[model samples]
Each structure stands twice: as structure tokens, then as C-alpha cells.
Target: MPSTDDLGSVVDAAVRARLDDSGQACDAAERFIVADDLYDGFVEKFTAALLDRRSGAPLSSVAAAGTLARQVAAAVAAGATLHTEGERRGAHFPAGVLTGLTTEHATARQELSGPAAMVFRAAGEADALRIANDTPYALGWYVFTTDSARAGRVAGGIEAGMAFVNGVGAEDAELPFGGVKRSGSGREPGRPGIEEFVGKKLVRTVA
Candidate 1:
């Protein structure tokens, strides 16, 4: 059987094909960097303050997404590998075979608000957990595994407010959504969803 990441790529490809069929090539993908050898391929692009990835906009006047601006700058400073998918066209960014991420890098610690991803290398479950928790923010997390027992164990250790386990898009109206640390301060659904927005008052008088 293919690895989960491989399966994920296949799914991504399928989604891209569907998007192409719908004539939305410039719509589905946002420009971002992918580095295989952080030091060799990604640093120079940053020194000149040039865009390391490709975006759909036709003009160079286009700027990086504000949400990702800081994170991208951090990645560049940490010297992580960065590049676009092809010859750097259309706010072009690296699009395939993403690799070369380290927990020590700022990219690993920061919350990426735009179309960016970091692929860190971890030794095992414990190490992965440590890396995951090393960050200050824990809005959400994901666990993809066939073993239910392992899933439960990992889920419990993760500090995030929401977790999607085993399956993707596994959300419902009844489940409360919120986060800890800097992710969120309150819940948005379930009973707490309405409760957070409400104010209750009571009065008593002798008759």
C-alpha cells in the first residue's frame, strides 16, 4: 500500500485535475516555496528579496500574502530550501516533492497564514509529539493512521483545540471548535458557541 503522504499527493493531483477541468488553474493554487536542500536552493532568492515561489498573478508587482509574509521571511532567514514549481512563472513557487524542514527553523515554530507547508523530519511518535508541542500556537492538528489505539494516544497528547483523526473534513455542527495558547480564546460551536455570546441576568425580590 502507498504511504499516507503518497495517497495525499494522489488526492491533490485529482483535485488539481478537477480544477483544470473547471478552468480554474489560476484559482486553486496559491504561490509558495518548496525547498529540498534549504541551503543550496532557497537562500539566494531571499537575499535579493525576490519571490521564491510562483503565484497566479500576472505582474511582478504582486506581493506575497500578508498572513505568510513573516513566516516566509523567517524561512528564508533560516536558509530552508525554496523554489517555484517550474521556471518561476505566475507568482510561481515550488509545487512538488516538498522536503527539507527542521524543527529548529523559524518556519517550524511560526503559524503560516497563507498557502504554505513545512515537512519536518521526526524520528517516532514521541519525537513528533515533542516537535508538535514545541510551538506556542496549537489551533488545530491532524492525525492520519489506521490504528485506532495510536490515534487516541496521539490525540490526547496534542495540545490543539481541534483534531481531525483518520479521515479528512471530519467536522460537524455539534462539535465545538476552539483552540488553546494563541490559536483561539473561546469556542465557536456546540453549547459553548451560543453561551459565549450570551449574557444572563437574574433578580430576586421578597413578596
Candidate 2:
């Protein structure tokens, strides 16, 4: 997936996805799996972008912010390195990035509910997919690549219900919005969502 040439746009889209709704959205991207070749550069740019662009908005409540701050602290206690702009104050949890986390870490499997990102260095495509699909929560997944075939293949391989390629904020009213696995079932705002409310009765009349 390192075939992605535009690092700037990818970083922008990634930050947008991670910070959306102050990282409270269930579908917001929580983990970033970067190919080994791009991992360092990606993390550097990503952390910078997060620090510079974060809206500094309060989460739902002060208690909610405290919970998120504790989550990040726990990750650090568990050996993950943290690169952050500022400490949590009130309901505004400043943007931070976590590195050196592995699939075995407890925080690796948990979702951060604030503007924080956990980055993993993947050896290649297979490793990337493994990290991406390892979680039980599969509401939304994102793939950034220049190759169309690779994009399709990676997107198809993702376990999430919705896969966004090369961009963020692609959700529309007409599109089905939902997740698979523990993220929840069924769709909304689309044909499938409509069917969820409909009752079907089987009637067979032989002529």
C-alpha cells in the first residue's frame, strides 16, 4: 500500500478521518497501519498535522474527556510511546499519536474516544490487512493507494461494512451507512436501511 504517492493528501484525509467529531464518531479511523517503507515519514507528518490542525473542541462532556485521557495514559503505561501537542484540560483532549503499540497490547484492540491516533508499522500488504481486520469493531475502514487494482483488492479484503478509498467524508444520505461484526448490523439511509423497516410475507400462488 506504500504505492501511495501523495503523502500530503493521504495525511490530510487520514487526520480528517481520525479527528472527525473529535474522534467520538464510531466510524472514525482509530488505527493507522502504514507500510514499513512509509511508516516513519507518515507518522511524522501525521503527528504534525494532528498537532497543527486539531480543532481543540471539547468532547461530549468533561467526564467523557477524562475517560479518553485515561485511556491514552493507560496505553503509555502499557509501553506505547506518545507524541502529543498538549495535555487534556476540561473536555478538550489535545491531539496525540501513539506508536510502538502491537496487536498484543490491550490498547491496540481498544478504540480511543478522542483525537488520538495509534500507528502501526506493517511489513507489507498482508500485514496491513491483518492489523486492519484484527479488531472486532469493523464499522468503517480506509485504504489509501494510487493503484486502482490494489485499492479494490484491499478494500474488498477489509472486514468493515464501509470501505472508503483515498478520501474521507465520503458518506452521503443515499449511501448505506453501517458496520459489520461487533460494530453492529444493518444499514441506514439507503435501500437496505429501508428494508430493515419493512415486513415481508410470503405468498405463493400456483397458476
Candidate 3:
């Protein structure tokens, strides 16, 4: 078993390494001092019991999965760019495996399940629509509406590149997948998804 002091040192080293890799440089004194403080704070909040080896009250894996999925989906809707780094962890699985599996451009309507759906429902249509539109990774977004007619109107009002009526993950090859803002620089799937990887050259024609 690693001593508390040893664990603290390890976390400190990890933080320093991350900062260094990100092109950050600080005096060793500052790094050590700050790292110690952060390590202490972390330990205070998260003790050895929280460690993977320790057993405690169990968490619902289903709920955990739902929460994670929703968070990822929300990030996508917010126009955030999703990229992969390091050893291609499971976090990259969704975007990597799903990107080209379907049409060139497709909208994924992911229905919230279990507690996740309740969370989404609580957000109300306006908030839900806003989250859906603002997320960067969204090709299209959907939520089940109490009123299909109302949902149709609301979908039309949404600013997302695409919107679905009480539907989730309804993507079409002919359609486009992209988001506004920080979602990414361009679209994917269809001509847009293709354009992300290719550049255009304009030719001048003289008659």
C-alpha cells in the first residue's frame, strides 16, 4: 500500500507532467508548493476509501452510464469539438466508431433513459432545446414532447443544424452533421463531412 505522502507525491508529479506537456512552465518552488496544497485538498475530500480497491456503497452503473452519455451528448449539442488523444480510451469509442458507420451525414437522436430521461424532462423544452442547439457536436437533437404538434413547432424554432420531432438519432446520408460555435470548424458526413478532410481549389475559366 502506498503511503499518503507517497500518493500525494505521485499526484503532484502527474499534475506537473500534464502542465509541462501543455507547454506550461513554472518555477519548481511554485509547482511543489501548489501541488502540495492541491494534493492535500484532494486527499481531504477523497480519502483512501474512495480508492478503486476499497468497497463501499455501490453506485448504479446504469445511472452512471446514463449521466455520462447525457453529458457527452450535451457537449456535442453545445458546438464543442470532440477529439481523441492518448491510448484511445472508451471515451473515444462513441465518436470514433459511430462517425462513418452510417450515412455521410447523420443525426443521432439519443433518447434519455432511466434517470437520465427524468433529468432531461425536468429541464423543460426551452432549456432542452437550448442545450441541444448550443452543443457543438450535434448533427441534430431530439426530445420527446408531450405534444407532437408543439414539438414540431419547437423543433422548427431550434437553431441546431438539424432538428427531429420527438425523435432521436435519426440520421440520413443526404443530410449533414455539424454544429455551430466551438462544435468544430466544419460539418461531417455528406458533402460537409467530406469537406472537413478536403480542401477546395477554385479554378479560373477564361473564354
Q: Local distance difference test, per candidate?
A: 0.49, 0.88, 0.35
lDDT by residue (79-198, candidate 2, tens digit) is 999998767789988999999988888888887888989999999888889888888789988888888988898999989999988888899988999999898999997898888899
lDDT of 1 at 168: 38
Q: Could you tell which candidate, 1 or 3, scores higher by lDDT? A: 1
Off by over 4 Å in 2: none
lDDT of 3 by residue, 1-207 (tens): 001334454443323322231211211101011122333454332222122222122223445444545544564555433332222222221211011111111223332211111111113445445444433343344433445666676667666565554333356786676655443446667987887788789999998
The sequence of per-residue lDDT tens digits that candidate 1 reaches over residues 98-176 is 2356677766776543334444555566766776778777766656555677678878888878766644344578877
Best by TM-score: 2
lDDT of 3 at 84: 26
Candidate 1 accuracy as lDDT: 0.49
TM-score of each: 0.63, 0.95, 0.34
All-Cα superposition RMSD per candidate: 8.6, 1.3, 20.5
Where is model 2 poorest over a 10-residue stretch in terms of lDDT?
A: 1-10
Query: Model 3: runs farther than 4 Å from truth?
Result: 1-139, 145-149, 204-207
Candidate 2 whole-model C-alpha lDDT, 0 to 1: 0.88
Pick the lDDT winner: 2
